[model samples]
Target: MFGMADMDPTGGLWNWAASSSLSGERVQGALAGALERTVISLDAEGMDGAVLCDVYHVSGDFPTLIDVYLAPETIAETTAASAVAVRLEVEIILPDDSLNPTRYVLADPAGGLRHVHVDEVETDDGPERRHVRPCTGDDPACAAAPEDKAA
Candidate 1:
């Protein structure tokens, strides 16, 4: 579980060519279904696990669900003041045959890109939507150490 870094109005979200190589087997843990809607949720806790969020995409007309967890602590950070970070989650339902869900990104690489998979993906927020910041880390402020990675 991870939290959304408060709204950072400083920089732009890192954008890249969209990727869609998610296979039914990629998300092995996901219950088999016809593929449908996506749900995103956020929650906050104390110091230990201050924040957490999950994206659930339901497949087909059946009643199955696919869950993707986002960890802010593991997200790429470019600044130190993530102070305003807040938890934000959303869900969207797509038609049964949505080979493409508006847009997509490549996350969690595996034996090269082919084996790579999608992570923390939501069908609602597409490229048309502008993001203030590339979600900074959930920490009230960037860690004492700046980073180029989600560590």
Candidate 2:
């Protein structure tokens, strides 16, 4: 089971590109590469067996959300040892589908999850990229409406 202590420090990197103009495929590729490097670094630190990582995309709205799930113990241990250094150049792109807004849920072994909403809005300056506030239990945007559920 994972807890706050098990969360990846590099998690913020997930939002690093919250305000860029890249394609969803490109963003996914970049994240996958970063995650690969993280795994390799862990292996180099002789902690390969201590951790496992997975990267997958959830399609919804523009600015598709990519979820990176890592084994808990490895993150805590490797972070404490300062073994992984992750650097990323971030840019966000809209998903192919324009029907729904994108929301990414990153879940750990214990079922704990974090939600990230990526979206773009038209502004006087052109298009502005932003992350909607993290979803809460009462946030209608966080989940489908009651009618949606009934349907």
Predicted model with the maximum lDDT: 2
Deviating ranges (above 4 Å) for candidate 2: 1-85, 89-99, 105-113, 122-127, 144-151
**Model 2 residue 127 distance off true place after TM-score fit, in angstroms:** 4.9
Provide the lDDT at 111 for model 1.
12
* Per-residue alpha-carbon lDDT of candidate 2 for residues 14-100, written as tens digits (9 for 90 to 100): 222223334444544444453444332222344443223322233223233332334343334223211111222322332211123
- Looking at model 1, which ten-residue stretch has the lowest summed lDDT? 80-89
The TM-score that candidate 2 achieves is: 0.28
Query: In model 2, what is the error at residue 107, expressed in angstroms?
Result: 11
